[model samples]
Target: MNPCDTMLADDEAVIRALLNEVPFNGWTRTALRRALAACNRDPDDAAFLFPGGAADMIETWACLADRDMEAAALAADLAAYRTPARVRAIISLRFEQNRPHRDAIRRAIAVLALPQNAKRAATITARTVDSIWHAAGDRSADFAWYTKRALLGGVYTSTLLFWLRDTSDTDEDTIAFLDRRLNNVATIGKTRKAITDKRPKLRIPMPGFMRTWAERA
Candidate 1:
């Protein structure tokens, strides 16, 4: 394997171990040290592995989760489903994959919610939604690309918040909530399409400022 791949695999191993401690230690350096020890790695290696400290560990864990979600989506052959259903499946897969580490996720959310971690939080969200869209077979490179990700980002975040609190069987309620949000976005998209169809001249290009904003996101 490539050296970089090996390094990332090692990092992921440490992060996986870290998840076990996060629920009790709340993503602190102490928790990371314990995780390293659990992995039979040097505790001092924590600084080299996650220089940004707890926030870095949280972000890495999230990115790893995104990769897992994407791989699962692909393995499930989502091309047979409609775009919305495909997206729904991808998001559901994410929740399912992380269910075992829900408390770790909750703790990570608390860390990410800090005012200083705002940028990191946004970056992680953008990456996650982008992964979802890609896994759903979306190949749009136009303005729709940005809009779709932005719409899904809101749906994803809201569904996530709801899921964290949901107590229903098998997260049935969370899935239902996700379906409703997806349906709403679909309705809005269709309405906008209808309007654009009726008034060709109304199909305006994405604003330059908005484009810049989307790029940053």
Candidate 2:
């Protein structure tokens, strides 16, 4: 199969194989990371890494996201159906960080137990979602879990992505965003309980043109 067109499952296996073959480090590792980043928006830019002249790995990565999300959600082994929003958040965060450890997943989710060193990021908060998965081992990672989990992942990635793109100091806007989202999620279920099933209409603050632009984006 063309390396470029390989799906994430295939890519994961290849990466695993490469790691086993040699020390997967140095310039080669960095190159692979950059290639993965560019593969989605600009596949041909990293086509040199692949055997065939034309193959798109990014599409397969997205396919992997879909593939794995569906697989895990449907599987009995996983605790519950992880929401699509959570999956997107995980993918987005993973892309932003370039690498993440599995332990980090535990902190964002309470039910899922994690190793002690897993989420030891310096000054990291509980809301920085580490995985796009439901809590396993003993109970269900239901709607409440999924919603909270999605909020955590979405807030962090959105904050960081914009922070990286932003040319400002202190990342004040990003922090503010985190605070606002945290407060919203924190109260949503509580408020919903009091209201007893009152549906919340998500408001779009942007003007008509901006709304359209965001959707297209």
Candidate 3:
């Protein structure tokens, strides 16, 4: 992947620079304008920079997190780990890297979780998991591609929520929670594969009535 492709634009960097001010000003267009003032940028540029207002800021923040996660993964030595371990490592790196920005992240999550931003939120979650998979050296091009990312999405989101609320001083509790979620996903995948492999494939269709009754059973 070209690192430049994920590089933040000047406007995005400006928005990120204002995260510390988010709690004070909130993630509004007004907040952005005020932030621009502090940065010696034109407040009128806010519209040009984030036409979607807070939604844009939140979405950009998510994208930035994904890019940072990928960069960290690239710098780390994860070659020795298996696929599951590597996935967990990449996700853990993301949370750890953003630890200092937890408040900003929490506020971003609130903005993304709004009813109007549901689709963007889902897109951001999907993209983050996709980046993690790529960084973990996954080369799947078939059904596993979707399944793996989908599973990780669930794991990562749950673990992030846990981390945000976790009171553990060293964050060991959050790490354990993340590990359990990943382990559960692995177990479920193995169990599903075993079940699928053991089930006989039927070339002939059963009678419609019988199939309907079987489905109810």
- Candidate 3, residues 60-142: lDDT per residue as tens digits? 77777787899999899899999888887888898788877778888888988889999888888888888899999988765
Model 1, runs deviating above 4 Å: 1-7, 201-217
- lDDT for 182 in candidate 3 is 84
The numbered model that scores best in TM-score is 1
What's the lDDT of the predicted structure labeled candidate 1? Answer: 0.85
Rank by TM-score, descending? 1, 3, 2
For model 3, what is the C-alpha lDDT against the true structure?
Answer: 0.79
Across 1-217, the per-residue lDDT of candidate 1 in tens digits comes to 1222234777888888988998898898888899999989999877676777787777788788888999999899988899888999999999988887888888888888999999989988998998899899889877678778889999999999999998875889999999999999999899978866766577667568877865775
Evaluation by lDDT, superior candidate among 2 and 3: 3
Stretch of 10 with least lDDT, candidate 2 = 104-113
TM-score of each: 0.89, 0.32, 0.85
Task: For candidate 1, give the lDDT of residue 141.
Answer: 78
Clashes of each: 0, 1, 0
